[model samples]
Target: MDNIAGTKSSLVWAVNIAVVVLVLLWTIPTFGLLVSSFRDRDQIATTGWWSSLFPHEASLRFRIGDAETQRQEGEVFVIDGSVFEAGGTVSAFGTSNRDPAAHEPGEVVDFGDGISGTVNEDGSYRVTSPVAFEGRSPRLFVTSVTPPRFTLENYDRVLFAQGLGRAFLNTMTVTIPATVIPILVAAFAAYALAWMEFPGRSLLIASVVGLLVVPLQLALIPLLQLHNAIGIGKDYLGIWLAHSAFGLPLAIYLLRNYMVGLPREIIESARVDGATDFQIFLKIILPLSFPALASFAIFQFLWTWNDLLIATVFLGNTQDQLVMTGVLRELLGSRGGDWEILAASAFVSISVPLVVFFAMQKYLVRGLLAGSVK
Candidate 1:
């Protein structure tokens, strides 16, 4: 009964649970990255994104008032001021680095010879000495608990100082043409294979499938040499052609599969009406194949947009031509230790792909129609 039609399988529940788990697995890191992008380096280093909403305790070193800030109060020279100029609560403090939290706030430490210092919970500090203060005031290490803070400075620095703005436009330049040209060319090829009779059609389809498994790394150097020979050396045109070539096989395979699945009656009736192949394709086939086209568009857009190797090989890595991935690679090398900047740059790079995916996701499953119909 469990295997019968209109009955549920025991594994269905397990599959649903697995899918929810997978979605959360992917979403959690992305959410963390978004949170981290808005934070400064210090907070990110000290705490995780989940802790960003609460106060964070950190041990910090601050210099007390220097000799110039000291004033004579009766017979005693005194230095009085808050260690934090803006905000922070001192929970504990010490005058030596070895025991930074040796004393609680509001407790005084007597250093002998009539020298004493005290720090209060409100970050205020006072030091009194019988002798005049000298250069280089005392170093105070305090444990402070600060309220949560967020900022847009990370985005500002990444988009402007890191050159991501220019790289963004360059990636758009490469990806848009790379995606469209392949889809247009593959649409024609797919229509011919699906409907129009032609010699060697089976061989061509077989070749397309064969190319799908072939790794692109095998052709990078050879393709670069070919680009140079054709006088298209190291330009957007060359990279566009490279992406289109690599993407075409999959594009044609998918569109052909979906086009072949369309009801045969429509094509036969169009042919009987004296319609040419181009007319059948433009008027009849293209409109019906929108799901497949959109599906391929999403794939090619994401692949070309995220591509680093092809862009590096065909488009020279000049600042004028660097893509988003290359610019991010440069950032990773130069600012590898700055997690905030890296998080911001990474989020910016994936923003467009996320939008494109969600926008066309409905068509994605519809286009995977291979062998669905006899």
Candidate 2:
């Protein structure tokens, strides 16, 4: 009964649960990054994004009004102001540096000789003394619970102030050309390999398949030397060419596999209708091959967008020419302690890839699975 041809398996629920867990494992961190990106630097430093929704308790030190601001209120000299004007509830406070939360909110602390101070729950504080104050204001330590805070300042600081905006544009410039050029070149080559007969077609296909296993690292130095020899060194053009060259083999292989699986009858019918090979490829093959194209586009886009090594080797890491990844690396080294900025920058970096993946994911399986069975 369990093995019945049309019946569902008991493990279907297990598979679903596994998939849900995997989705959560991936999604939760990305969601946290998004939440952290919007949070204040101080909040991100002290607490995790999960605790961002509720009030947060922190011990903070602030200085009361200076003696210059003290005035006579009948017989007593008083200094009145707020410890936290930005809005928070002070649950506990103290006048001494040693014991910050010595008394509950609204309870008075006596220093000496009629000098007294009290802090209210709303962060206001009043200090009174029989004699006038003379010098610096006393320091007040407080335990406060503040509402969750979110801000765009992290994004603002990274994007505009830290040069990520320029790097973003530079990355787009590198990635778009890199992705598109290879796909165009590989589509033509793949068409030739799949549909058009040639003397060395078998060897060519075999070579492409063989190239897939070759590590990009092996070719980096040779390719860089070649580029320098050809006078295309350390520029956008060089990186674009490098990415396109590195990506071409896989693109050709994938597109060839998909194009080979296309119906023979359609090609024959087009030929019978007196359509030339070029016309058939343009009019019939491209439309039919959209899934494969989209799949390769997603791959190439993701690789080029996230790439650091190729960009570094091909495009010199000048401040003006650095890609997003390079700029991010700089930030990591320079602002390693600034969690909020890193969170925002990381989210910014992954956002485009996420959009590209979700937009084209429906075709990914179709493209990769093309010709696998038939």
lDDT of 1 by residue, 286-308 (tens): 99998889888888888999999
What are the models' TM-scores?
0.84, 0.87
279-354: candidate 2 lDDT, tens digit per residue:
9988998899888998888888999999988988888777678988888888899999898989889878888998
lDDT of 1: 0.89
Tell me the deviation in Å of residue 294 in model 1.
0.5
Candidate 1 scores a C-alpha RMSD against the true structure in Å of 4.0
In candidate 2, what residue range of length 10 has the lowest lDDT sum? 365-374
Evaluate residue 356 in candidate 2 and report its C-alpha lDDT on the 0 to 100 scale.
Answer: 76
Location of the lowest summed lDDT over 10 successive residues in candidate 1: 365-374
